[model samples]
Target: MFRNRDRSAETPAHETALACLEAGIAATLPERVVADRIALDEETIAVGGATYSLDTFDRLVVLGGGKAAGGLAAALADRLGSRLDDGCVVTTDVESGSVGPIEVREGDHPTPTERNVEATRTILDRAEAATAETLVLALVTGGASALLCAPAAGLALSDLQATTDALLASGASIDEINAVRKHCSAIKGGQLARAAAPAPVVTLAISDVVGDDPAVIGSGPTVPDGSTFGDALAVLDRYDLRETIPDPVVDRLERGVDGELEETPDAGARAVAAAADDWHSLANGRTAIDAARGVARERGYEPLVLSSRFAGEAGEVGRVHASVAAEIVAAGEPVEPPAVVLSGGEVTVTVDGDGTGGPNQEFALAAAIELAESGADAVLASVDTDGIDGPTDAAGAIVDRGTVPRDEVDPARRALAANDVYDDLDDRSALLRTGYTGTNVNDLRVLVVPAAD
Candidate 1:
């Protein structure tokens, strides 16, 4: 399943690390998780621990957007067969396509575009036409925030693009970034459910945020939003983004905060109350971590799951992982050597340099430096589960004691400081490229420590 499996200068430990990462990524595939949680019988359809009878609705419509929406819809089509009347979803993956009654439309990611706006209009139109008798199966996941763009009144696609670019570059947390998105979008923050008012909407999600908050995932199109316009404005102030944000975005947010405009539906809103019992969003970081631990054991390494909610700056997290490996080698306090430590979560990078590198690349380079200084023999690898880390082509990077030569230590330090780890890793053949993994669950990090010699 790994595309870059063969490369020169391969170490046995490097191969093991690659296997561990591939295993974790594979475990989060949309088809695998969707099949496990969704199923159908003759007259009854089950999803996320809830059962809905086919006889309860006059029509079954599938609607959603995300990185995994294509696969999720495919799996549902297989199970639902002819019962599915129609379906449509937006995604960034070009390989995604329609199957049966579902059509997976293309959309730009990390930034909203005109094509995205047009495609989203169709989704909203279909949703708005739904009635109480329509059974709506909603797929919400990572990338949906951008893929399902529907700018609020007075805002253009340019406004959304500018705001998104600034927010992503500001190193803001996903929750904070999404709070702003929900308020500016017409279909987000429970508006989709409102559009399909009085209909029974069941949502199946693949979480990519740290806390797995359903309202934060894909900006909560089918779930109730707890954030308000005031919260969105606060995020901008916290990041000092008021000056850089487009004028229209600022105006819209300010107007909503002052009650001059309507707010996105909150948990107590009537729109959410109408379809409260019929919604669900499942699949999270733990889903991948659990599967990864199993793979570690199969590979003959004692596994230590650090935490499923790991967060912080990428470089600092990398150093901490190195420190833990050093402790295992020196004191054996946490666990003996020949152990694989696993963690999953999204990490941020505060970009100050014009260099090209993502959070995972910075993490690996910083960890390599720490391991070299501590004289620790360990292999550290990290990758965004989506197969795209920041604006780079490599999924992430891997490093070890021998990754940086003794004489080149100073140069490596300079590269990391300049945020140019991508060039350095590429020169050393350390980057891992698997293209788009067809699923996203934030990031997966692994530290492999050898047994004491």
Candidate 2:
């Protein structure tokens, strides 16, 4: 939940927006999601539409890494109870702790680290130990690409870290970033499935990517990878990062492209093919967006879900949202007044300044300026569903027509130009801070336009 909800919700519209955001995020919590999507019967377990007999497997083990993996492992442990033999899950430091019988290990995110490597090795070890009689429950989610760090042969952790940092700063889409990641890592891109070969692996994922592509989510550790080493090289070229990123990454990718190294397992790969029917997406941006829409309707507002697949530059996306608000206020083109326009998807910000802020913060700042300039009587709030936007402590921010005073518009513009929206939003008391909300379905945005008087 937002820590400053009361302080930020100074108006009825603000209150409604905050409530929608809370509902949206709550709908994706691992505990809630797992409980809704997974069920245990007397002798069988059901996940989504698939059911497996518990007696079929002599051992059940969990192995995965991500921001939500710890929570997912805990919830699953409760459901499996004594049936679970042992498990290990690597997650972000904030979410790490012992969960029932599972060992929850801590790791970094947005960047890989030595801790991540060690924790991921433990996860891989568990996966590799599984036999034909074992049922491997893989709890992969957003952030697993970083949390489950395992450099490819001849690549060091530092090479991955540098590549990750460079790619993140390049304003690349999550799909593109993961394409590169799937090539550079040893455990990602169906390698985890290969490690647990002969044993049936069931992956329960919380999608944080656009299109809800399992192959891109968490770099598709349990699913077949559609990307190739050539694709990875193309990402670096597209981002102009080949020269800037570590040389070793370039070399490894080049080697793979030249057929000197094996490519990530594809759909035809045995391990991926065997478990093709078992990968389940527990929740996604649409799940949160729908929850937000329901809450908006309950709050006496007509809900208009824009899309759950919006992408591109964060500031540009925010401007588009502002234009929608302006249209609703002026001519009610998309919908009449008293509407809460909702959207959910990941957005990226290209960092050119030393200042700090995440995509949602940048979005809020841009939208705030547009709302003030256009004189739209509306409140807008955006937050990363995982509760951490960029490297900042604030989840995102909330703003409205009054967020920017007349004299400070230039300053606000400067702040955004410098990639310092976090400080500027904080100065205006617009930053929304919520630390690590248990799950990730990407970014959520709410725009509330009041009915005209």
Candidate 3:
């Protein structure tokens, strides 16, 4: 029997399999893979052969929120050393051993809370206090939208909360949800950067959004935003969220739309186009592919890297990949046997059934059902790099032909509901958990298509 209690098959390379899964995940996160790629030394922060003087600023303050922000800040503090002034960062993971002069606070993810609002206010205050001589190193990573929350002016907590809930439940994509959220918040949509004008803002981005749009990544807290109140209203309209919004939310958005308030900083605006601002990308989805390719070479398998920017509905994406992997496992057509198919990107869950799993979980679960129903010979794992997927603590899940047993699963029924895979993979002890990785690139998935016997 395998290490699993009810294991039907055992591979001598299970440890290697687990290592590949972990490495693939680590490769996606920027902070984990970027330190070596960029010159982050004690004296300066350098990228692309250009160096920024670290000691020129009178005070160095780090402020941001995300699943990876804590770890990334810690790495920066480690690199900055004595140059770093008092620093505070909020993240889902509370890592204690950060570089130095930095404070870590835990925040909720995938959903905002009263504490999230309060913590964000604190971060804003820190940003606002920065002077011309101060250098603000903004570490914006994945999960930031929920980790840091602040309602826009005249918007109450209840209003923001209600609007967010409705938008998420309405099958809206992240881009759409963020458009609404950026308008509804004070810190998002480049408002954070505008808040700390004259003070140099160097943004270190670990992009989880597709196409790597800075304005959409964590709603562009430290970068300039192009999203407007009109765009936000359009998102709400496109999703038919007008009638569903709370009265207070409708009123607040109406006020903004009527020019009663200023919109988030516009792109190409003079203030945002200044040389005082610096933006550098540490890593992204491609890093995961690189990591998987190296592992594939070591494991003696041909590695085929699909797209790193795969998106759309999570369950549907899983079905497509599962079908391809199944064909390779059974018939050995596309790439051959003993091959691994690797993909990395962020996927969305529309929240119809309000199931507990995230995009990765939904993908794994959907794939599991597909494998189980078809009796495929493939092994697979799907995991979020930050170790938390959706509302649940598990980053993601793993599966094979032994997922739910052949004659058992109601395949069409489960995938119809979003992320119901958590229910099935939970029984197999395949849920991957690593707490918080401190860095996030997005989701990483690997499939093992063993040779046909």
Candidate 4:
């Protein structure tokens, strides 16, 4: 699946890291996850061990949004075939080929657009149309929050845009960022389930957020939201973004806090509890990290899964990973040489410089600098599982001792300082561009170290 398959073919360590990455990406394909977890058996549909009798429902409508919605819809179409009456899904990708009566609508990502609002409006309409006899199969996945944007009352798309910009640039955690989103949007934070109330709503989710909280994944359109407007306001204040955020957003949040605006349906809300089913996480970061570990072990390396819940600043994470790799090389501790270290989680980047790079790119860049400084013959491979890291086209990058010559370390450091890791990695032919992988599970990172000669 790697377009530049031979980019790291010369180095055994790099080859192992790249192979592990491929294994991870392949494990979480939306169709594959759906096939493994969802099954249709005549009057019965089983999702993640929960079986629903099809005889009870006169109609089955598929509704949801995300990066993997199209693929998930296609898989469901094949499984359900003619049983699917109507469906609509919003996604960031172009309308790729879909099956059955499901319609795929395009939307923007990392930021919501007017088109996203329209698409999400249609999705809400479909949800609201669900009758008592209708079974709503909702596909929730990563990127759904942005793709399924429907502004709350008194809020415009531009308001959402400005608020999103401020929150994203605030270096907040995903939970914190999504807390604000859940409160501001019309359909998010269990509103979709509320719309489909009185109808059974079954959700199959591909988790991209840490902790796999249904409320956080895609901002929990189907499940109940535990976050409140107060939480959103606290997030803004935590990031010191209260003053800079759009006035409308601040007003909305303040109104919500003051009980002037309605809050998102909490976990105990009847609408949320009535229409929602036992949420299923079809795939997640652990799924990718486990598959990668298997590949690493198969390649004769002792694989150490550092953590599937790794978080924090990308650069700091990178340096910590580098330190672990150097330890393996220096003292043969933590399983010795010929070891592959792996982790899967989302990292943050406090973009101080107007440079082009995402968290994974920054992670790789920082790791490269650390390895070079320590004179460690280690290789690092980091990539967003969805194939797009941050705002850049490059999925991520690979770095080894040769990625930067000893004399050029200064320039690499400068690039890292400027958050311009993309240009540096691109100049050295290290960026990995795999296009859309039809799935997302946060990020996959691998650090490989070989024995000294």
Candidate 5:
């Protein structure tokens, strides 16, 4: 939807911006990052710090699920070729084949469906038979929680959907949501690693969670789980979401938390005890920094790559970025005018209102509000590499000085209140939309502060 009249070639600045966005998103996809981290030698695969020699293993197979699991599987097949044995991966963004010996099955997202549950079962069956002589390449990435759906015993898909919806609507942080997800799923909370016991499991991960906590990232399908049913119940209680949760599902988790039900295996569990697997972090915020730097340089602006581990409430984070921009413009403390500050990380929305936007959108809108109040001459854009944010279609939004109003801005406040940042910026043509970018590197934010006249 290029609405401008210019049909000429894209300028270096425009191209750089687009390229940065694309690269930032692609870098988070499991296949793109994992394949690069894993190398194939004469007879072995070296992933991260662990090496699995074909000479030592009878078979090498890929089995897992996530938004990018299929892509990762396809890439591994490309590298291993005929050497790669049978495997299946469940994901939301399925495309035409790029590799053999790996099957890509379509799955759901945001909430798990019956089809997702069934596909997850299929993957589990494949993992259960893994032997020590076999190499289990478990591809884990963002969205694994929804992609690899298998409800706990007695939990139903409808129940999961409702609970998931509440969590989304409740504005619970990703960590909190996934904590509950880990407890409710049969395969999460390191259960997948447990299922593949006796086998050497090499997990090539692309972290979407801040700090990349293996146990929390994608609900830690292959890592040892330290979260308990009590933790899950605590999230529900902390968010006051108990009423929204299904009774049977709550009862099941409550039982587990109360000790009537067995707890999920902890760090000392056999999966960790067996020493049968290794966790490999393949990619993270580095890509975003590189892309941002490239964009800023191309735009004739100084680029400063800050720590990408940004986290906290979306609005609060946006205000911090705005303050930095204002400081740059007024005093040049961090950098002179004509500078860009780029960062990457996941942010949270506390769900204070009925709004249609993700963390990125909320951040942009919030920053725009502050920029307007302070009369800051800057433009801010934040986006989720996965394309869909929360439940909205817009990737994110862009905010500039023109976006900020001089008078009391009740509209922006209302938008933020309702979590409807998209509507607030719709008139300005500020919403950034890229449907399903096939990757998820968490959140990317770019701030451009121009020089004063």
Candidate 6:
């Protein structure tokens, strides 16, 4: 639920956009997603389209980390009840809580910390303790790359922390950032599956990445890694971050490229082959997008789902969305007026300025400027499905034609250029704050264009 929904609901268009956002987020909550995808029939348990016989394993334990892992673990624990022998999961402090028999641990995100390393050590220990009779249920989801940290040999936790910070600020795609992270970590890229070898690992994932590649989600701790050390080094080169990042990180990758370090486990690797058939993606951006589309239809608006795999710079994407709105208002080209455009995907910010704001905030601010310039009577709302945009507590922002004051247009442009749209949006009462919504399916954006008068 949006905490500031009432305050932001300035018009009918604002309310419709907010409703669509709420529907999208609610559809992906762990309780709803888990209940919809997982079911128990006596000794047989079904997850997605795959069924597992609980009678086959002597013990069943849960292990993994992510922003949504805590909620997923709690939902799964309730479903499995006494069948779940023991479990442990690391998540953001906001999502940490009691989960029956599962122990919930807190860790930082976007940047890993000493606490993350310690919590990850516990997860790896649990994985290493698994035997042939143990069945591990891995709850790998968004933010897992940061929540489950393990420094590779010859590297310290500080090395990882510094490298992670640099890569995130580089505006690299999640896949690229995660590719580098997998190579630097000891528990990523199917390494956790290797640690829990001989025990069948069933990965239940909530995908936040584009295309929903299992190898990229949570850096693929429970699946084979398709990325190599060479690939990671290339990512740094592409961003020109090799010289600026931690020295040890570059050295480690260079060594791996030279065969000094072993690569992450691949598809042919024994660990991956053992549990390759058990990985399941229970929810993703499409799950949320579909729900939002249904809400749009019910509200008497023709819904146009652009894509659930959008990427690139956030501001540019916002401008494009605004352009579409302008066209619809001008000539009703796309689907006529009273249309809602819905899209879902993860967007990146290059972080050229010292000001604080996430991709969603940047998107909304950019769209506001474009909407004002085009004189389109519409409303746009964009938010991270997890209810936290970037490092800020505000989920995102909602903007209308009047959002940018006519006289302050120049100041608004300056704020956006400085990446300081958070305060600007706040001053306009356009920010949407909902705390942590206990789920993450990347970002959801809605553009509501009412009938032209």
User: Residue by residue across 1-453, what tens digits does model 4's lDDT show?
Assistant: 777779655678878888999999999998788777777866888877789998899999988999988888888888888788999998876563346899888888898998889888888998888899999988999999889999988889998998888778778988898899988898999999999988888888999998898988999998888888999999988888878888889999999899998888886888687645567889999999999999988988889989999889999999898888888888987877788899989998987888898999889888888888888888999999999999988899899867788889899889988888888989989898888888999999998998789
- What overall lDDT goes with each candidate model? 0.85, 0.90, 0.74, 0.88, 0.77, 0.90
Sorted on lDDT, best first, the list reads: 6, 2, 4, 1, 5, 3
Each candidate's TM vs. the true structure? 0.96, 0.98, 0.91, 0.98, 0.92, 0.98
Report lDDT (Cα) of residue 420, candidate 4.
Answer: 85
Clashing pairs in model 1, backbone N/Cα/C closer than 3 A: none
Please provide, for model 1 over 146-209, each residue's C-alpha lDDT reduced to its tens digit, 9 standing for 90 to 100.
9999999898889999999999888898889999999999999999988987777888889998
Candidate 3, residues 261-295, lDDT tens digits: the string is 87777766554554224776677767766787788
Show model 5 residue runs off by greater than 4 Å: 1-19, 29-35, 95-98, 273-277, 297-300
lDDT over C-alpha atoms for residue 6 of model 2: 84
Candidate 2 has an lDDT of: 0.90
Find the 10 residues in a row with the least total lDDT in model 3: 1-10
Collision pairs in model 6: none
Name the Cα RMSD for model 2: 1.1
Q: Select the stronger candidate by lDDT from 2 and 3.
A: 2
Cα deviation at 276, candidate 6, in Å, is 2.8
The TM-score, computed over Cα atoms with residue i paired to residue i, of candidate 2 is 0.98
lDDT of 5: 0.77
Clashes of each: 0, 0, 1, 0, 3, 0
Greater-TM-score candidate between 4 and 5: 4
lDDT per residue for candidate 2 within 1-453, as digits (tens), equals 789678999999999999999999999999999888888755787888889887999988889988888889888888777888888998874545677778899899889989899888888888888999999889889889899999998889999989999999999888899999999898999999999998999988999889988888899999898899999999999978989989989998999899999898998998787776799999999999999999999888999999898999999999999999999999997999899999988889999888989999999999999998999999999999999999989899999989997678899889888998888998889999989988988999999999898
For candidate 2, the per-residue lDDT at 375 reads 92
Candidate number with the higher TM-score (1 or 5): 1
Runs in model 3 deviating more than 4 A are 1-9, 12-17, 28-31, 95-99, 275-277, 415-419
lDDT of 6 by residue, 1-453 (tens): 888578888788999999999999999989998888888755987877878899999998999999899989889888888888888899984545558778888889878998889888988999999999999999998999999999998889988888988988999999899899999999999999999998889999999999998989899998988899999999999999978888999999999999998999998998776666799988999999999999999999999998898898999999999999999998897878799999999888998889989999999999999988888999999999988999899999999879996778899889888989899999989999998888889999999999877
